[model samples]
Target: MKRGFLEACVLAAISGEESYGYQIVKDVPASMGLTESTLYPLLKRLEKAGCITARSAEHNGRLRRYYRITDDGRARIEEFLAEWPSVREIYTYVEGAHHDAR
Candidate 1:
């Protein structure tokens, strides 16, 4: 679930415009615990899944890979949004159960 959430967040970050690794890290909320170590592999996975496309551009005389969301990636964001109600329902049930136990 966390992985899926991270993927959705990353996709949303780039959904607005093309973005590079460091920018993506900055775009996603710090509370999400996004780190350089976690982001690269996740970017590769998203690329592999065809949810995003990567291209290289020179910035400060060095290559920077930027990612843009693909059609599938947008669909993924929508899908995650659609699932929110169900997730919320489960959370509510769990919270109620925990209070009952207490």
Candidate 2:
């Protein structure tokens, strides 16, 4: 997936509730094959974009920064969800083509 599209998925992962970077890494599919390096920069970009917010909380004697979706983020997610059906249809068509090649 493109970086911008993947960022939307990251936003979706946080939509249900606030979550830490590590938790999100686990929650999002391994197929997305995310890493801290890729994710943290995306998180920072989202924060800058006003799509998300970060708050630090004490946990296990350490401060963990949690990412929460903002109203803008919700709007963005809604937009992506609305746009996803077309993307899904493309994927389905591509997959069918790949299968026919076998």
Candidate 3:
């Protein structure tokens, strides 16, 4: 479940434009706890899933891999959005339970 959320976050980060690993880490909120160790593997998974496409380009005399969201990635974002209502309901239920426990 957390993996799905992280993937969605990464997808959304690049939804506006293509980005590299370092930039992606910067683009996502710090609160998300995104790190190089976590990001590279996630990027590979996203690429493997066809949710994004990667290309290498020269930057500062070095090759940088940039990722752009694909049609499937956009569809994924939409799918995640579609699930939000249910997630909200669950959150509401959980929050009520937490309050009751107080």
Candidate 4:
């Protein structure tokens, strides 16, 4: 179980490029689960911390807020990337152990 922190998931979401809130929430669960309450504050905090920036655009007559990773966010992602191997190793070991037990 490589459950990541909100910042990690949010960072992962924007690693490739920018994304809207709904897209981030929607895409995350496919690989890592995230709920509205969990993601929203993280976004706000990141915005305040200068790790991300937000912009609004009209989509289907509805204004959607999009979050883009800034230089600071990219730097944070690099830090996370450096730490990820250990996290991944734990999950892989757990999964392997479970399979071996069967």
Q: Tens digits of per-residue lDDT for model 4 on 1-102?
A: 243366877877887888987789987855556777778888998999899999999999999888999999888878888988998898899999999999
**Candidate 3 runs further than 4 Å off:** none
Query: lDDT (0-100) at residue 69 of candidate 3?
Result: 99
Best by TM-score: 1
Task: RMSD for all candidates, in order, please.
Answer: 0.7, 2.1, 0.9, 3.2
Against the reference, the lDDT scores of all candidates come to: 0.95, 0.91, 0.94, 0.82
User: What lDDT is reached at residue 9 by model 4?
Assistant: 77
Q: What is the C-alpha local distance difference test score of candidate 4?
A: 0.82
Whole-model alpha-carbon lDDT for candidate 2? 0.91
After superposition, the stretches of candidate 2 with alpha carbons farther than 4 Å from their true spots are 92-102
Q: How well is each residue in 1-102 modelled by candidate 2, as lDDT tens digits? A: 577577887998999999999999898788888888899999999999999999999999999999999999999888888988998999999999999999
Cα deviation at 52, candidate 4, in Å, is: 0.7
CA shift of 14, model 3, Å:
0.8
Q: Model 3 reaches what TM-score against the true structure?
A: 0.95
Q: Is candidate 2 or candidate 4 better by TM-score?
A: 2
| Candidates 1 and 4, the one with greater lDDT | 1
Minimum summed lDDT over a 10-residue window in model 2 is located at: 1-10
Model 1, position 102: C-alpha lDDT score: 94
